[model samples]
Structures are given as C-alpha cells and as structure tokens.
Target: MAQNILINDLPLEIFIKILKEVDGVSLGKCRRVCKKWRDGIDGSDQIWHEVCRKEFKHSSEIAKRKAGNICRWYHIYKNLKMWIDITTFDKKVREFYKFSLHDKSHALDVDYGVLPLKDAKGVVFYDMSNLKYIPVAISETNCCKVTNNDHVSVILTKTGLYVQKCVDSNGVTEGFFKAENFVLSGEVIYFHNGTRAGELLLYRLSSQKKGPMSRPIFDTLAILPEGKFAVQLDVCERKNGPLIIASTFFEIILVEYDFFPHEQEPKCSFPVNKLTMYKRLLRLKDRLQSS
Candidate 1:
C-alpha cells in the first residue's frame, strides 16, 4: 500500500502558499484537517486580511478599518457575509445605506446597488444598478418604512404592507396590516403590528427560489406594552443558534430558537430593564411562600 503525503508534512512556506490560493470556504475546511494546519492558518493574519479584501470588495474602507481594529480578518469576513441595514443622515436629510454588518462597508458599489429613499409623500425605490427610481405611493397620513431582503423588498405603511420581487417588475402585493417598524432577518421578516406599542409579527419566506409566491407564515413571535416600540431589530448568529434581538426605547429583548430533537418555539427574554431585577425578587418570594 502507498502512503499519501500528509498536509502537515509539506514545507511551511509551500503550505501557506497553497492555503492562500483557495477560497474562504475551502480555507475553513482545511483548518479542521490537522492541528498543524489550523495553527498555521489561524496565525497568519495577512492571509485572512487578503481574503477579506477579495471577498468583500463591495465594502467601504471605513468598514475595513473598523474590522481590522476589532478582530481577525476572518472574523470580519465571516460575520459580514450578510447585508446590514445602516442608516445615516446629514444636516436635515436622512438616508439608509446598506452596509456589511461586520466591516461596516457599503454592501454594494456606488453605482450598482439598491438605494432605499424616503420622503413625506411616500417611499421611493432607487435602482442604482439601472439608474432609475420608482416612487411607491403608500399613505399620505402615515410614514412608510422600507426594507429589502435577498428575495424581495417590503414597504410598510400605516394602513398596509406592500411587497415586490427584488429582481422583477411584478406589481406590489398590498396587505392590510399597519406597521410602525419592519426589518428583514435572513428568510424571516419581523415587523411591529398596530402602533408603536404593538406585537412582533414573524413572517418566514418559504424558499429563496419561490420568493414571490411565498406567503408569510403569519406567526406572532412576541407582544409588547401599549407605548413601547421596537426601535431596532437584528439577527445575531451564534454557536447555539440565531438570536433575534429587538430593541425598544425602554428595553432590549433577545430570543433564541433551537430545534434539535423536535421543533420548539423560540425562547425570549423581554423587558431586560432594572425593573426586571425587582420583578425576579418578587417572583422568588411568591414561589417561596407557595413552597
């Protein structure tokens, strides 16, 4: 029987060179091959930095600088593979810029990108890719919130929710659900229904392929106080699973969904304010009395 040449047995310079040539996904696989490979791959910051630059050329220099300051380039690349909705405003004008969450770079180049614009009249969808903008009429009385995911773009107004295919000219589908704020997290879309103080609605898109035909799952994930509103919503992927974090003016809520053996409902921690400390103590006293 002939023995194969082990990867670790190869010269260090040659191994590094070989790893540098492969894509980020392949580099990850190579790390699990052996301890020697792992150390060699992990220790070299330059390799990962180069990979970050190549993979996320669409990102901005500011994002690159920020990521380099925080952690390894690989960490930045892995975390920022998804688009993060970042809003920026000038003296009086507010605009939303899609940024790489990890590196804080613009998700697309200056010319070819989806630019979401808003005004008092309605929400405007700008196709920088084609140098065209479409004004979507919502409600004149209420503000409209717009969000785009991998498959479609959603516009939420006080009276209805509108959705259109990201890559098509299909007319928008209007659903009668007044929303205050909305965000897209992976395949699931999260929105606050009713007023500022409303319920958190979760709508999971079936598949990326059949996006237009995919209907919302119509599941209510959580409920909030009458006055409290969700100011921010984002998904953080972790070792355990994906964490859905919704932040309100009064509190921040974190929900973790884990379905290993069987499908389980998401576990949520809400109103993580100082009041919760007192509430926990009061609950413990009640339990002690019962015991």
Candidate 2:
C-alpha cells in the first residue's frame, strides 16, 4: 500500500486548511515539523478563536442535554468554563452582543463566522464562522461596598458575588474568587490592616440583605501573615461553606486553635514556591482562560 507523505508541498492556503482541521495540541506538534510550518501557524490567531468556539458550543450542548436545572446549568457552565472563559474585558461590556444558546430543534449548523453584538454586557463569544454568539441565559448582578481598605467594590445581585476593581454590569464584581467555600491544608495568616478590633468581617454576596455584616466565617488564629510562607492543617467545609481558600497566598493554614484531648496540631503544609511564582499564576490563568 502507498501513502502520500508530501504535506508541505501543498500551497500555503492549503496548509492553513490542514492546520484548521487539527487541534491546539496536535498543531503544536505540527509546528515543530519545520520553520515554515511554525511561521505559518504563528501568523494566525483566527484558528485558535474558531476551534475554541466549536469545542465550547458543543460542550455546552452536552451539558444542557445531560439533564439538570439552573444548578445543573451552573454545574455545566462551570465545568466547561476552562474551554470558554475570556478575561480580556471589552471595556464597553454594557453594549448588547449577539448570541444563541442550544436549541436542539432548530440548531444552527453555522460553519462561517459570527459578529460581535454592539451592546454586549457579558463576555461575547462570537462564532467567527457563523456570525452568532451562542447564548447562555445568565443571571447577573452588581453592587459596591465602601471601605477604607483597598476601596472595596462588590456586586452581587443574583449570579454571584464579585469583589474587584470595578462592578460588572450584571452587578457582579469583576474580581475572581476561588468559590464560596475553600479548604486549607497548609498554614495561612490574615492581614489585620482592615480588620477592626481584630474582628474579621464577612460580607454575604447577595442582592438582598439577610442580616448584619462583620460576621466571622472563621478567625485567623495567627492573624494575617506577611510575605510568603507555608503551613499545614486538615481543613474542610461544606458546599455552603467551602473554607474560603483565598489565603494571603495560595495556601491556607488552619492553625490549631484548640487541641482535642487526642488530636494534635496539623502537620500538613501548603505548598510554597521558592522561585518563579509566575508558574503558579500562569497555570491558574490558563485554567481560567479555558473556562
């Protein structure tokens, strides 16, 4: 049997078409074949944009058909975030953007391109091949809190609490968080610069006020530690309380406040980076980008 092995012989446009059929990983391999291939692929960002849309759109459909309600929707949305999350803000997010979600009956098999909605609020995922931004019904909200520390800005209407530099149009904070609850296996310290009388303040991210503020979720036994360090502990929390892991650094140390008659202080320590913390950050950024 004879197999054609002359791929590079094809025209540049044909080579691009070939590149389009492959994926990011495989494409990485393809680029390694020769300098020509590397230059050709590097010249185009359009391919990355196209493949990503298809992957996410299909994944979204798979999530919806999996059978679940809003919780399920959130579950799927979050699970598939790695393939669809875009952090670069449009600055003009208040503008409406065109989008279409899953509609099994009249499903759009667009293979061309999509246009960005002029007045888009949330992140716009325009299918460059079909001129449509696949839609996902999102509940959004935003609110601000004034404080002497860092000029706290928060927005939590219904979707979730966002604490960041500014408020999202949906009233969510543009700032990113680990989640409602997180656990700690390593040492963690709390900075007292903002705490009043050493009382850790807690803000319930919701549109409606349930009660009061300044409620402590859990006290920092050693207070907030400065610089970077590591510790160990066995920390856990329920879905309602995920042991917020947004530590001063990446690790959280639940210092043994009280020792059980038989229990000892936690020996588990949070991982510490000796150099080039950029690796830790870039890994996170990549995950967020894919989401």
In terms of lDDT, which candidate is strongest? Answer: 1
What TM-score, to 2 decimals, does candidate 1 have?
0.33
List model 2 lDDT by residue over 126-221, tens digit each.
Answer: 322112333421122111111111123222222223333322123532354433322211122122122232122232233234457644343222
Candidate 1, residue 57: CA error in Å?
Answer: 5.7
> How does each model score on lDDT?
0.44, 0.31
Reference-based lDDT, residue 278, model 1: 25
Q: What is the lDDT of residue 171 in candidate 1?
A: 60
How many pairs of residues collide in model 1?
1
Clashes of each: 1, 52
Clashing pairs in model 1, backbone N/Cα/C closer than 3 A:
60-105
* Top-TM-score structure, candidate number: 1
